[model samples]
Target: MEESEELQSILSYLPLLMRSSSLFWPSQAVETLRELGGGRVDSGYLLFQAISHLRNALSLSSEPLSPSTALGYALFFDEVMSGEESRKWFREVVPVLGNLLLRLPSLLETHYQNPHNSMRTATALRLLDSQLPGIIFLSQELIAALLGCSFFCLFPVKDRYVNHLPVINFDELFASLYEDYNQKQENKIWCIIHYFQRISSNMPKGIVSFERKVLHLKNDYTHISCPDANFWSTSTVPLCRVEVHNSGLIEDQSSDAVEVDFANKYLGGGALGRGCVQEEIRFMVSPELIAGMLFLPAMADNEAIEIVGVERFSSYTGYASSFRFSGDYVDEREVDDLGRRKTRIVAIDALCSPGMRQYRTNFLLREINKAFCGFLYQCKYQLYQKKLQDNGCSSALFDAATSTSMETSEGKFSDHKTTNSQNDYHSMDQGNNIGVATGNWGCGAFGGDPEVKTIIQWLAASQALRPFISYYTFGLEALQSLDEVAHWILSQRWTVGDLWNMLVEYSTSRSKGETNVGFLHWLLPSIYGHDEVIQTQLHCVSCSETDKRVVGMEAYLCGLLAHQHRYGLVDYSNYWMLCVALRPFISYYTFGLEALQSLDEVAHWILSQRWTVGDLWNMLVEYSTSRSKGETNVGFLHWLLPSIYGHGTGMDFSNLA
Candidate 1:
């Protein structure tokens, strides 16, 4: 009687099951439902209908499933899941089971703990065994082996790995599948990396902190100076501020070569005699005579050689690329609280980029202290940095890593790997957010992973007191995704702790060359519902690329992107998707690379002005590649040479005659 009623119940809704596909459901499910609709299998549709009703149950009920319905769900689920559809639609299937399983305690009562006679107890093994591995990249064969062997053991593991179907090697499988999905997924993930809000634009305005009435003035975090009638100057003598230049005395050159006549020219030669009594004073004593004696009979903590400052004879305005002359003004106000307009300039010995080691974190921090020690007492810069890093302000920044300024390489591609050791990654002002204007921080000029470095910088800035990051993304679609990814992670409510662990896992998997289980996987979980990800074939950044063989007006601009996989620029897949999608074979390279080569010569020919290594990164991705999307060859070069990182330094783009 029960079986007859169940069969009648399944028949009522089996006709309503049409073709449906989702990330959680297999494409084969539509056909499977079609097969069941043909009246060939009545029992199979019965199992299918029971599972389908679970979705209806959840959509309708906020409460748990009834005791009887939950038990029936487990038995029917077991019957249908013995088929391939269970594995294919595993993501959709598992959630229903978990929800129904919630009612087990109510149904079994006390026997729920160890119900040997209960069907729910009998079905408990299936509940545990039926769960599909949540990870998407595992080959179908590995998955089958995993399912067969249970969670803890790998005995059923055949020596072969598999894709949606089957494969021989684990490493080789991901090597092909990974990059294909990464770039294809990025196509759908269009990040708004750069937003240059103009004075006249309708974009959002930032909170400007300028002159306003405030409570008290505090220098850094220490040394608060407040006005009170109680505090008064005790000393009658006027005081002079001493300027410390850690670089050593500016005018005190080494005493090596000097004739007796020149030496005694003005009471010790190079000394100036203004004839005034104050200007005629000469100094020929050790530092100890003027300041405190050295500590530990070695170096003094506050010991600094007094350095002089001269008035700047010129003036300039604007920061970075906006710098220009805005007229000069005379400075008559000389309060000189620290010194008489003096600057203790510590001049370290000049050193070129010595094999790139000079820019490493450990090395750079070593150099920062040359000036830090001089201002340690009065300046709270270092102290401020410590406060920023430790105060747990990372949650405040959601879009920190959203800025990136790089593109795919034009030559042979090699997978980049990194280990997440946040300790090794240090910034002196880790949390200061103090005007850190940077581009290509760990790539381009140095050998490093652009993605990893960009992530690290974002993580550092997230904890900063005032992070004013400027990512010059150069209008590249790929670069913009960094920020978009950051935005999505935040929108999904992933915390810093979540991202840090995800990165560590991703880095570990990256080093092992795992498929479908890294940064993008963590950032965008929605893409992995279907094992087979849909991807568009590669197109030139110059979508309207001209044919090189059939010579025409712009035939010279054609250059082939080197060693493209099926997805062109992405370093995956052996098979290109379609002919129209794949770019036509040209004899040259990527638009960025070719344009860079041409711009180099043009920049020198037009004017002798040199380009800085970071010059191309202007206002976060608005640099050299801004016009690279459509223009080809000489036209690209012409636009680029001027605008790069072209349009050029001051060349006008207007065709105004």
Candidate 2:
């Protein structure tokens, strides 16, 4: 055969040979095509023929061929095409290639549906790395598609080593690919790598360089640093080559150096000086000096720092200068008519031992009480204004009634209504019989308007309503008062339950012999009703007969309330609190299928409440752990043990069933 004729014949049959299913002699066909293309006998024509053959193969089946064969074909075409030709071909063919790449996973799912096929897929990906490195280049969608194929192929496989084939050596491939693109493409590279890093466990190298470049581009100097020992350490000293002027008009170098040093020192000092004086001063002294100043030996036997004053239930014991409960304190004068003399006040104080005092007094309760009264006064004022707008009642009759009422309540009302004109205006507005009233003056005044009323009513009906209501209206208000007494105990910072625990501890330890459990002990009965109290008592009768159940119940309620206050919703914390609170009942009820049913109810509640799935899973794990202990809730063990802990004996039919 003539060489040209033979070359033509080989080229003519290349497409058909590439697409053939018969594996026998396929490499021979590939070699023939490569040799013809290598000879430069109609080079472009040969390259076109190879691409056409590959395109035909890609078009032939939706199913993926053995990736090795597919990759071999791709490499053959890539080898034939010159860099310029590759660029031209890529620009023209990439959209099509991208579409094909996207469909590759689905095709693999159908055709390459075996363990050996995964290796083929990996090989194909390597070919993609060689030929169409720019195809997956920085395209997250394309990379994700590629990863999807690998993940699905490997997911069913048990061996971890084999499964990692697709991702192995990815960093080297990425670095090489990124170097091909211009700086304009850096962001795309970053986004792609960032996502890949998040999902894949193996950390990609050169990532810090990419990150630094990105930060540099963004001008975010906060994280900027020179190559440091920790990150990019080097053994050799870096050298700089500078071109010096031969015309030596010597520069005044020493003065410039001194000026620079002076500026740096002053700026550094200014920055340092801006920090807390006390902290800076403390750092300046040695422990020996501090001990000596405080009249204690540096290495004395009692070296522990002591905080005096209120030793509250906090992790730290500290001194407080002033303490008062959170509340609106009515003056002894105003409530005197109600026959209430001196208002009871609780003070919370935190004090440090040996020195310094910070007073946190709840004198604000009186201020707050006045504020609530002011709110009521405002409500009354609005009502009076509304009445004045209406012309229904006789002005004289209104005036007479107002005068009589004012005269009769003169002494009590004098302080509250300071001005005569203000009193007259109040009486005149009260005289007008307009039924028109602001919602604030109605039955749901402090609840805001009708919307707030509606919300409150809805909450009142909810199972979780009690905690919600108490926290907002009274419980949280009380917490605020308590916080005022001790500035650190802010509402929502620590729950009423935490305060109660602190109070209980304080009551037990008070040297003055005054033991008041405070409102903490009353919280449970106030919220859950007397029936819950009775049930709790019955459950805890054996543990302690004298109010121990009540105390436990209160603690539990407080914990739940605190959780709600902090998180802005009832969550797993509340469920855990409830579990702790009802533990005695849980123990009593754990003997039979009914207990499992209750456990199911709790699980269902967790699901129904739309709690976080992770939190629910954790709760189930905790429940399983508790049940595994052979404690009270053995029946709970049956359900929790099987579902999450994976320890229960069964046919293991969940997967199949």
Candidate 3:
């Protein structure tokens, strides 16, 4: 047959073999073809025909093929060939493989991108990474030959380019691998460290870089000499000298001239009395100066300064010079006698600037006063509440009796008698103890229908008593109320600290305790003017604790009392009064809206607070400007301006600002 006819004939049977479910037939047929082609005079021709058949079969097969099938076929060809014959077979097979690969991009675009295909992209990449290594190694020459073909011949440019790619540098590949490995290792180490710290009280110190020595010295400062010094002795020698001249003019000279040779008098290399000039003679300084010079030597050459008796002084020339004292001695006070004597010590007082002392004292006094006032305020609130409870029982009883009788009474005559008797006695009692009756006496009426009233009061007192509830039934109910408020606040970019502070202030300032009642009345004209204690109760309901509901509630109450005094309503509170009050607000707000606001308000608030297109654009600008550091306070401004303009007012940014 002609070459074209031969190729066509081979291709016809290829599809049938490739699609056959019986792998045994295809393997045996491939083996028979390989053996027959090996002896043919036109071996290349027969091999090429066989390879073309396989390629055609691969292309035409309608049945879905597993990766194992492709692997099996490749392995079969590899096992049947050797040397030149193997090269020839690989060369013929690669073009078909290249053609197959060329179809991948299109296949990916269609099969992978199509939502219906649902191909696992990661699995595909992993498979490629795994299979490419073997293909590149086994058919290196054939793949290289195919790469040299025209881009449009049988395969696309991308396929040919990838197939014939050379081995990447081992160093670069290893570097990448090492980096990835190191990062994973570090992550594991960090995870171990965190686990140990979290799960155990005692943790190994190996993970931490702690100094074991007392000083934890990074460098040997005590022994190292100055870099300028020739040796340890040279660095340690004092630079100052006192000399008494023949003219009786005492003058100071640089001690740099006092070399190690001159300082080491014990060497005895020169005779002490030889060529001595008595007229120009002068006594050397004290031995203490010489003793101060001895120290351990530094090992490093650059560590010369470390050996110096004192830290090297700053100078333009890089060498430190010592200060000197020079003066002519009086006739009675002999210069030799002064030189022989020990250096007199001078005692001096530590001097401080007037402004510094004043500022220090002022800060100290302020802190002390603040602490004292805080203590006094706490005591006063406690005493006040105790006294109110003790004295207000009579009025509370009167109110409770009146309320109960009104609800249960049958007729006007009975009601009149009850009212007249109670009122006549109340009027007379009120005349005498009006202050006590009006203040503390009212709390006894707090308990109405213990269940219903408690629930309502609890609902109303959410901010105050929420932290104290042992049962979560009310909290679950409250959560529905808190959702809108929390979403509104958290959706904004306020820092936790700023948000926390604001909630604290609002809760504290609006409490309804007796002391805060006066301020609540004052602020009533401005806003809702709700009772401070009730407002505090509402804020407390927002706390996020799981079991300490009662603690949270009492904290809220104490915070309310503290805040009232802090704002001058109670006369002795500290600056942190508002901060304390707002603590519950932050906690509860985080718990979600069920603890705070009604569903309607929450939904409306959340919808209204949604970021608008303009706001997003502004945020982009703000983010960009912040990255470039073009503006100092853009973040704060973004938060504050919108807040002041009522952007998040319904959610309450007043205290935060």
Candidate 4:
């Protein structure tokens, strides 16, 4: 029988169905009606009638229905799902839904339940916002319920008040199945479906909290103390430990560390839309993280959001376009003091520079401050204490947060000391010891330079007192020198300030149009030093690019002499010696075969001009082709003088090559 018809027909026989052994009814439904029996049985019958009427109304609607309504769950089980597979899946999990809705009044502790208490108002089940730093602590059951609401597209569209928040409904995800129908989007839906299935069968008993951290800063650059040359250039703190991995992912490999979400300023990015990269993929596996989007607004430059105790319910392979939902995953992370998982995910957006502007000093400072704002210990510790107290535990029960010195492969270093003593939360704490697990932030579609970004994040982590950094390169070829540069800095025992100075110097050079050299090459003096060796390497790299038209012993002699002159190894002062130098090319490669053509005139012209290797070769080509092309009879010096100066610099060949 249809769910609405079954519900309606059974209401009149509630007393009979209650005693009939053959009738099969959900126990929660039976208990619900029983609770309101006696004088309230009529009220219970009216409740079921209203639910049936709502279900019939939803059944007729051609558009999507919001899951927040009680009948929406029925619509999900009936019309939305299809095929024997969904039916079979529904049969196994329908009781959980029935019980959930029957007890929705208690599960959903809305703000209206108690208007007098501010703490309750803040913690109530509602949309999180950007006004002030707010946190929502939810039980796993409540999270599943919210996810159900999101799954059915029950959340209202972004209106004036909610426009700041990202789209929390699954309408876009569902629409894609009919509009484009690709496996990537399909896999995302599968992941979310599997999460509901898993939670419905064996609901976990842990709590999760999402807190947004905002650090107010002055708009005036002159007044702001951060990113100051003196402060950054004088920090005594050494760099934390850094380990780069060519393989693996940030979410799976660095679960113990504070995982960074390469987020869009709008928290979830295109997670509900088409974006399936770092931030989107993270949301799919741990769908509970999506709950933050319902309340959080587009992040400000000085703000970040940290989600603690979110359980990862699905595991997957591939990234972005290649992403696929692999299979179910059981979250085994241990619970914290408040019966919450210990997993912490911090969302910090990098500056989006679709062009070369990201390399500027101002954007660099913005990224550094953004990372610092996310890494502050206060975000986790202060909110943690509040959560503990809200759970009816004493804040004093939690020990004083403390931070110790960091130990690197080189040796131990003192804890990071901040110059901004005015900020009390800048003080060290043990929780600050969590390393940051990050890859190239802002480099993918955002166009940030990975090498510079790696160092920026490192400096921020050091200032925030993180002990180590698990840096994932994701196989970017640009970061090939990351290990070498990191090792050199450690070997030299350079402090954060030293690196900051180097970065500033590099940025200055870049702004003045001197970016031929990359950041890593600029930082490592030894690599860019020895002009001769660099020139030689450049030539070797472009060896195939040599003009094939010019060949034989004359070409060899020209190359030899050019190499000699480039490194300041050889010099020919007079025309006689210069003729001797050109003797090989004149005898072997010239078409006119002018072996004894008294090249002294041409040689003296070459000598007087002090021609480089390229000029000499082009002069040789002119002399040899004089008879062959017949135009050479127009006086070799006539047209050659103007063209000879074109190849003035031997080093210019390296650029061409």
Candidate 5:
């Protein structure tokens, strides 16, 4: 009965094995084939060894498959040796097996046409990072399934992962593996050869070639502070807050690329985007200067690169998709302390695309710029202005590339979203780049998502080795929230490093599809200590201890009140007022009031007159009418907070009318 049950289980796995499950243990087969190629296994042992590996890999996959998958090849083995007539036919396969094992990449390459060839594609994609193993054996069904496809696929292998493959002459291995078991057969050998040639011809150029880029940031006076907060709101308009040029096409109006006899820094697209800007600058700038930005250092998430004092040799018109070359103009820009033009170009890569399962950070295998040019270049203005406010650094004329991709994801910082156009690969081919023709090329600073741009610049400041970097943010209400959060962390006595670690954790976790993660979510578990005030029988001490444990919503409010009570806020009753005053627009989350009661808080905020009196009256009437909770309505609050706290109730709506 047990044997019959096992057989039934084996039958269940047969279809999955035949279909080429991506989870299968081709690695074991890979190892066995390599061993066979080492000449340790003789001819008679070849078929048996290959069959053993296939079975082992399947069983180890933890998915149930039929036992026949591993053992059935032995049955065929016996038949090949059944008589002299069969022996000749079987002998043809022995030498071919060894050669095929050595040419695994080409074998995988040939299998691209299979509809269910993800494993083959996966294997091929990992070819640069993995060693080629010998003699991969799946069931005959699996083998046939792989060899049946005919399509084109080339997964881009970034520069960072190419060191794993052994350096060998693939052409020789492929040539040696091409022997037809029955080469004399006109029909069999010719068709196989023709197919091999076709697949080999489709190989992409520089498929596994990549190199590192290097550019240095002078530590004149700046040190990169991790997770740029940019929290300070300056009373005076910052250089970043306004554009100096009169025209939207200021870049075009600037000294023509040819007329600007010299510059110290010029911005470019990126090293990975064919270094488009740098490539164009080559027409006017020195080739040596252009080469400096080439192959710069790798950026981790939220990192920025600044190439200082690179002279812009040419000027152009149009933005992305519609970019064009216009006539050159003369550059009259002043020199800096180092006597280099105060020109700077920055590279800021987007973290990750929306909804991608992987976060791009130091953990990424390969990284390139996305659409973060908006925040990156804008922040450069902020930094450059800051640097000027302090002092200046030495020479410029270098290049910069963002170290990693840190997309402005809405994981820990609030669910902020960018409304950039969707990225389509065929944009250029379809002529969709120039839609109406009068668009801007600049990745204008992220005006809508204040938190994203602030965090990005602040984080870059933390990691950079520049002379001066500022973390002041002009994030309106968001900045106030962060300031309060910082105070809360201080009250908790948590270190800045610990908070940075959590920031990294939240960034990575969210990018990788982790859910229920917030910047402060981890703090929740820590807040709940021990989970016990355990005592079965009631007593004075126990009852007192139970009282000490605050579990209700009121307990949380009381605790928070006590914590803020110590902040020396003069009028603690006006806590809501202070929050509303500092941040022009207030969310319930401004002080954890939203979680307590959205409607009640909104009503109270209006009656407090922290906002306009009209808004309070309007919302109060709306809430009174909706839920009939008129006790907490605006009129009651007018007497409770506003009227009592010095606000005059609007008896006349003359201005509003």
Candidate 6:
């Protein structure tokens, strides 16, 4: 029964196998073939070992062909091999495998149509770094050749941290086959193999462009802390038209717009690993997108990478763990003068907080900045290129084929090596007024709230001057109020600053324990003009029931503070206000609210440590928030506060008043 089940799984992959040439072998079989290649150089021993192994395996079995032999037969047989004739045809398939193996090196070195493949680099492909705004243009033929290298596992292993590049080889994908043979991996393999077959039969003459965009924050300050930054606050841009569809998908529904890849910092994420989510699935269907991993480094917080003109080759069903390759898909998008498809993909990774910690104001700013960096169309590179050409320099002076440095009064360009050995491919369109096609970015395993992420993208697109945004919710019922919220915001004619300020206010309230309602429901209070809690019921707890109030963290702190205030336990509600202000810190301490029951207790603790009331509160808030990050639980305050309180463990606290 087990042997039969295994055979059935192999049978399932046969149709896609026949449609695509058998040269795209499964990873397990590919790894076996790699061993035959005898390291990087194929000295004819590869063909010898493969043929001898098949010959020996065939002699042993007349009924069931060995796995390697079956893969070899898959290369030649247009029809399914069945019955007695399968055994007779095994010998003929062996030489076909040898012929392909022999031709593999030359095929990758030079395309049949182009005699001199100048794009094929003699050394490793150049890496794109975060220091400079850079673009790489590659002919579709070059991408096909590089992908062929990946299929054969020819690229060397790279450490992402040291090299700042993602895994470009197919070893990991193929290695997964033997490690754990599963349906998802099989589906992924099908999509990639089918892409190779399509291109091998009819190579695209067009090009694809990959460019990195960086938003330089002023004074070297990071993200939200740069108060002088006016990227959002200065923008009076109004929200654009948003079409929220719960039933459709981003890639299919917004085919005409720039598609969002909910990417990892390391571009493809688990696309080469065990992951099969949004970014991974997209990479599988449009395998050319994977070529970005060959050169682009992990994205920095302020950076985004955009790839224009890569064609999608396959359709898919399901998502994440349940994902499956549906079948071959024919891309019908229009091609431009560059022979490029009119498709654009911008990859932006969001802050990954798998808990309520994501509700913090700082994280909100990070996400907004990252999205804006991607949506913004103009870059200093384009501006400098135009400036140089307008000065009567030959257009070819700055042609992508040469190693040129661009400097402007704004700033000097950081040095970047050309990605292609021959010519840097240019993007077909700048998409200045193009809308964005995105939905629930960072909402998956990253733990971002979809409601929050939707508004974040909207604010970004608006600031970038996009005309419209098509949001695909993938049928999440939590987002049924999405259309309602979008229309209401649009009806008010709120500018980018207006919506951004609202998000900042919402995050502040959430951090203070004032409200736990979803952003959509939170907006309803203003929409309907009522104080009633919209989505959830919040019950006030008395002092004694603080820990058992069915609420947590901030609520628990709120309850304890309110109870202490209601009773005349402290001389000043002002002091309790101070405690409430310091709630984030006091609540995270070892004794919880019980430690500083009243303002006097806090004052006394400070007095005991010889600190002024101002100094005490400031240090506590700064230390806790900084140390705790945005996490709800900072653990016993002793771990963090002791480091702050003692200055050093060697100091003697016994000398304090």
Local distance difference test, each candidate: 0.25, 0.24, 0.22, 0.58, 0.28, 0.58
Residue 109 lDDT in candidate 4: 33
Q: List where candidate 3 sits over 4 angstroms from the true fold.
A: 1-169, 175-541, 544-548, 551-657
* TM-score-superior candidate, 3 or 5: 5
User: Tens digits of per-residue lDDT for model 4 on 120-144?
Assistant: 2244444445645556677777677
**Lowest summed lDDT over 10 consecutive residues: which window, candidate 4?**
536-545
Residue-level lDDT of model 1, residues 586-636, one tens digit each, is: 332234554345543543443233222123222113333454654333453
What is candidate 3's lDDT per residue for 1-657, written digit by digit as tens? 122321232222212221221111244334433443343312333433443343343442332222233232333234323456446434444334333333333332232233212211111111111111100001112212222121111111222123322111111111222333333222222221222222122211110000000111133323111121111112111111111111211112121110111111111111111111110011111111111111111111111010001111111111012112122221121111112111111000011122223123232222212111111111112222344366675354323323222213222122221122212211211111000000010011221111221121211111111111111222223222232333333333222223323323332443423223222222211122224434533332121212222222222212211111212222111222232223331211212323222323332333355432223234344556675876544343334234433566423333211
Score every model by TM-score: 0.21, 0.15, 0.12, 0.62, 0.27, 0.59
Q: What is the lDDT of residue 86 in candidate 5?
A: 35
**TM-score of candidate 5 relative to the true fold:** 0.27
Candidate 2 regions with alpha-carbon error over 4 angstroms: 1-375, 378-481, 484-516, 520-573, 579-639, 643-657
Task: Give each prediction's root-mean-square deviation over alpha carbons.
Answer: 36.7, 37.6, 41.9, 17.2, 24.3, 18.5
lDDT score of residue 528 within candidate 6: 29
Superposed model 4: Cα runs more than 4 Å off:
1-84, 98-102, 110-128, 158-162, 219-230, 379-432, 525-657
The C-alpha stretches of model 5 lying farther than 4 A from their native spots are: 1-289, 302-304, 337-339, 352-451, 454-657
Task: Report the C-alpha displacement of residue 435, candidate 6, in angstroms.
Answer: 0.6
Cα lDDT over the full model 6: 0.58
